[model samples]
Target: MKMNMFGLFNKKKSDTVSLPYTTDIHSHIIPGIDDGSPDVEHSVALVKQMQEWGVKRIITTPHVTEETFENTPETITAAYNLLKEALGEDAPEIIFSAEYRMDENFLKHVKNDILIPLPGNHILIENSFLQPFWDLKGLIYQLQLKGFNPILAHPERYAYYYDEKEIYTDIYNSGCMFQLNWLSLAGYYGKETRNIAYWLIEKGYVDFLGTDLHNRRHARAITEFLQTKEYRKLVEKLNLKNDTLK
Candidate 1:
C-alpha cells in the first residue's frame, strides 16, 4: 500500500515523529491481512494518522484468533516486511505484535511455541467482547505459566465483563495488564464502553493506552479525544512507565 492513500504530510524531521501520543501499543493497522485497516494503503493512512497525533512508536497488532484469522509468525513476518516497505525506514518505529484471541486454540499455540511474544515478553490478548470467557480463570493461569504477561485489549468493550466488576479485579489479580482504546473514551464504542473506560481509569485499573486505529473513522475519534480534558486527565493520572517509547 502506498502512503499516498492518506496523504503523508511534508513535515520537518522534528515535527514528523514528535511524541504527542508517545506509545500506542495496540492497533489493527497491519493492512488487509486481518479485520483491520483494509489494505497496505489503508494501513499507511492509519499509521500516518497516528504519527500526526504524536505517536512516536507504534506496535501494530492484528487479530489472531482460532476460528478465523489464525495468524502465525510466518504470516506476520511477510506482512511486516511489506509494511516496512510501505512505511520506508524513515518512518516512525513500527513493531509487530498480535492481539491474540484467548480461545481453546490459544492454549495449544502458547504451549507449542506458536504465539508471538510482545517486546519484553508482553503479549497483547483479547477475549470475546460479546461474552465472558467460559474458563477465563484457567486461561489466565496458563498465560502466567507461559512467562508472558497477557495485556487485555479494550476491556471496556466487553459487554459481559462490564457488568461483573469482579471479572476485572480477577483478571487484574491474575497478572493480566489492561489496555484502553482511544475511541472507547471518546464514546465511539458507545456510552456503555465509554463509562467502562472512564471507570477503569478512575479506579486505576488500566495499565496502558492504545489508539486501536483501524480506519479514518477511528482516526478522527482519537484525534478529537487527544484534545479533550478527559484524555489529558487519563494520561497524566496514569504516568505510564513505557520507557522504550520515544
Candidate 2:
C-alpha cells in the first residue's frame, strides 16, 4: 500500500502509540440510526474496535438531519439502549449525542431545548456539504447564550472554505471550537483534506480530533493511521480538549 500524509504504510513502528484522547466525542456507532453502524452486531463490533484503539469512553454522535434522518431523542436513546444490551458489561463506556447539521431541524431542537449536548454542554454542529448555514454565527451566539459550547464538526471537509479559508479563523474567533476528523490526516478523504488538516494543526486551531467512525472501513483506516509517526506527532502537539470531557 502507498503511504500518504499520515505515513499510512511503508513505515514501521518501534513502539505503539495511543491517541491522546481517551474519550471519542464524535462517532456514529448507534445502530440503525443514520449513516453509521447498520445493526446491533455492527454497533457492538465497532465499539470493540474502538476499545482496541484505547478508547476508554465513546460519545457516539449520530446524525440528526431534517427530512433525511429526522432522528429524535427517543429514537437515538432506544438505539443506544439496544447497543448497550448487546454489549453487556465488556463494552466501552458509551454516551448518546447527535451531530447537528445546522438546519431547520436543528433550529427547532435548539428552540425546544431538546438537543443533546456533549460533555461540558458542548454542541457538535456542522454545515451542509455544499454550503454553510446563513445564520451560523448567530446560531453559535444563541448556543453560547444558552450555555452550550458550539463545536464545528470537520471544518476541513467543507470544500467551499478551501477558497475562503480565513472563515476558519473567523469561526474560531467567534468562540466555536473546531473538531478535526482523524481520517483527514490519513488522507482518507483525499489530499486536500489532509493538507487542510495539517494546516489547521499548524495554525493552532484544532481543538478536538474525532474518529467520526461510522463503520468498519473507518475503523480500519484509523487503526492503520495510528501506527504512523504523524499520528503520534499530532497527538503530542494538538493538546486536544477531549481530556476535559472526561
lDDT of 1 by residue, 127-189 (tens): 886676787778777777878777888888888876688878888887888888878889997
User: Clash pairs of candidate 1?
Assistant: 1-41, 20-54, 21-54
What lDDT is obtained when candidate 1 is compared to the true structure? Answer: 0.76
Top candidate (lDDT): 2
| Residue pairs in candidate 2 whose N, alpha carbon or C atoms collide under 3 angstroms | none
The stretch of ten residues in a row with the least summed lDDT in candidate 1 is 10-19
Backbone clashes counted, model 1: 3
TM-score, every prediction: 0.88, 0.92
Candidate 1 root-mean-square deviation in Å: 3.3
lDDT of 1 at 28: 86
Candidate 1, 165: how far from true, in Å? Answer: 1.1
For model 1, the stretches where C-alpha displacement exceeds 4 angstroms are 1-4, 7-21, 244-246
> Per-residue error at 113 for model 2, in Å?
1.0
